[model samples]
Target: MTTTTSGPPAAVRSVSPRATVRLLGAWHTTGPAYAALADALRSAVLAGSLPVLTRLPSERELARALGVSRATTSAAYARLRDLGFATSRVGSGTVAALPRDASRHEVAAPPPAGDAPASDTPSADPTTPAADDTIDMSQATPSASRALHGAYTRALEALPAYLDGGGYAHLGVEPLRAAVAARYTARGVPTDPDQILVTTGAQQAIALLATTLVARTEHVVVESPTYVHALEAMRRTGARVVGVPVGDVEAIESVVRRTGARFVYLVPDFHNPTGRSLSADERRALADLVARHDVTVVGDETLTDVDLVGAGVPAPVVGDGTDPRLVAVGSASKSFWGGLRVGWVRADPQLVRRLAHTRQVLDVATPVLEQLAVTDLLEHRAAILPDRLAALRAQRDDLVDLLHERLPAWDVPRPDGGLCLWVGVGRPVGRALAAAAVTEGLRVSPGPLFTPDGSGQDRVRLTYTRPAGQYEPVVDRLRRAWERVGGR
Candidate 1:
């Protein structure tokens, strides 16, 4: 019988030798050097760091970059091809790919190890096991707030008012825009409805801002181990991402000055993974530095409301929020319900219009029902936030206590706000531990997933978004994984 097969996939783009080397973090564990290199490459491919169809640097080039022999690099490439994490073509050289038989449980790249919306977490492929089968420690978002259902129900009652008009709300429905603007105004940053552009989520807000402000071959300064997906959005604009130490305004200024970077992305309120918030002085310094450099700043406040210590969320990075160069993104997914997919951008009215126009090519509008629900939820936030905070605080405390009890060697710092603890595992075994976790039916986001240059090999982010009851199992799984990986 004759059979037909699809043609080989073509490489859309090439990752540089430097970037390829960065992705292979801590590959020198006890194993054959080539096998170790191949394993690292395979892990990166499976983790979605080296996305499928990306052309790898040539073997010789990578060998030179990695300080390894060309034969080692060649054998590593061959191993990658044998395991189906890569394929070769005549002109494409080597490209990342997934095996045809790869299972869903194996392939869904772990979500960025930060405060991204739970709904945005990478999920198993269609053929993967059920949700109950795996302990997902990647996404740092909470369950739907208790108020979400009532808000949606009210939205349904209010839906008919928009039935007569086209559902397209390119700038978002007026109520949601006004609600979002009012919240920003109350947060000490005066805002008007026109300055608010509602998006499907904070992620979409970031992408919209990236598309609107960033240009090809420009520089975008970011925090090291910042929001990884934000890096993806900025890089998609062909902008080079330059990372500085988190919360270091001096480093930020230096990078901006040296690179002449016109764009800056910060998670100043409560940083993901690390769960660190910039001090008031740091915020002021960042604001002044961005202003001085004529830099456009995107302050991601997705986790601003996840206050475990009740210290109240800090002010926006750009305090005034009127600067045309300052844009702030907020999301209901982290605070209320990920399924809502509701978020907003607060920026200059002109930029808001530009974003709305640019967003049309991507999505004409966020769903009107979701917008109305978000509006209702925001209006009732006073009733909802306390309960959400209480639950998170308890869960966070429980996870911390459990980790301390079970994994005493790891340094687990308590974050004032934000959903995850960025724990130091005392060894560069994040990738190994994550792999081991999977064998125990747990999925994790290792440290490398959070950084642009793949330098956080000694860390792992663990979210307390899971119920308190599951904290023990989560710790148990992590403990077993640590043991399996021989974590110090």
Candidate 2:
């Protein structure tokens, strides 16, 4: 039943007819053979007798060897796929896999940093996650929506008055700040224009906070496998960043108390790598932590508006900006496009004034034209998000289907919101797979790249931000890459 990959030739193994019959018990006593066979396979998978990604017998091959009709065999395989216990790879055919366990949440925790995969494993030459002729799956950004094009057209119309001035808006363009503040008020967070300071992007907003809030060698509390850029920004400020896994607010609070962290950063809404949100209880607890500990909290809301189909809105961590200790960061990047490069920080007016002066040292001011465009986009966001959500929903489903059909061994969790899927490929070969994929012209980020302390070698993050048509070619390239890995 088991065929091992020997030294020279790592042969592709298919289940023998005899072994297939043995693995699956008699089905004649059940209502129907196909359904019964599918159930048996599921049992085997759950029992761990058949490890993930083990190739199954082909429909015709199994039918011929088992004396069953080909239609019956095909139905059995199809049923297995529908139930999530099996998936098909192009060359690999149907493979055994673990189904989604209802008891377990898809938003699993990042393992401890010391649990990193062994480094001595054999691999091809390392390839960058993105390069020429590669299907880029590294970054979690999407193209500018049609709303952005319209916003740009309107921005040009509003540009003349600002053009006559010196154009250095350290406090940002006034109208945009007012518009952004109004949006926050409408969302249950009342705000004032003076409390809003615009930056080039959310990344810049965080970068500025890294400088203003963090003193040298001070401790900063952050999510371990958070947005990689956020980790980098924390380090750039000479801060000793302590990381805790998501879903555990207590761990963060413990760190804050133990280290007397000057600032704590969290992406409570649609977190980047895992695409999960804090539970309502957790959010309330977080607000309490901010008040009781007298600690400054930075709430990153970049992915707040990107809530996927059927995933309802999460309670904002710092709603209405009422808490003096909380600073909220909002961005048009995730909702509209990164190319617009406009984001803002909502805090106390005095803090805003101080940061605005500090920001003057960074880049003087955000571009006035882009700020105007963002204002117009904010005006029409209600109309735009629904269409955008519908398209993204379809694209997410397509990517899931394609991944199941093309890379059967991979454990793909269905994320309810955000642009990316955090996946588990069934081996300690994320880096190797990514490198091989790049050689086959597909750019993918391995799991270890996201961890602050370098872990998660069996995981990969995939973005569904591109067009629907793009998924097909990407999966095709991935299939070829998987083939190359098996052949080696």
Candidate whose TM-score is highest: 1
- Tell me, by lDDT, which candidate is best: 1
Q: Write the per-residue lDDT of candidate 1 for residues 1-488, one digit (tens) a residue.
A: 11113366765446779867776777887888899999888766544445555678998999999999999999998988888777887766887777775432132233334311122133333423465888898887678887878988999999999999999999999999999988988989888899899998999999999888889989788876878799899889998776665776776776676568888898987698788888988888877887799998888999888888888866776687757887788999888988888899888888889999999988899999999999999899888899889888889899999889878988899889898888887655566667667766688888767766555666788888887777887888788667555543
- Model 2 ranges off by over 4 Å: 1-132, 480-488
Question: 109 in model 1: Cα distance from truth in Å?
Answer: 26
Clashes of 2: 1
Model 1, which residues run further than 4 Å from truth?
1-132
lDDT for 349 in candidate 1 is: 86
Model 2, 71-176: lDDT tens digits are 8888988888777766775555676654555212122233234322212232343532345566788878888788888889999999998988999989889999
lDDT of each: 0.79, 0.74
**What is residue 224's positional error in candidate 2, in angstroms?**
2.2
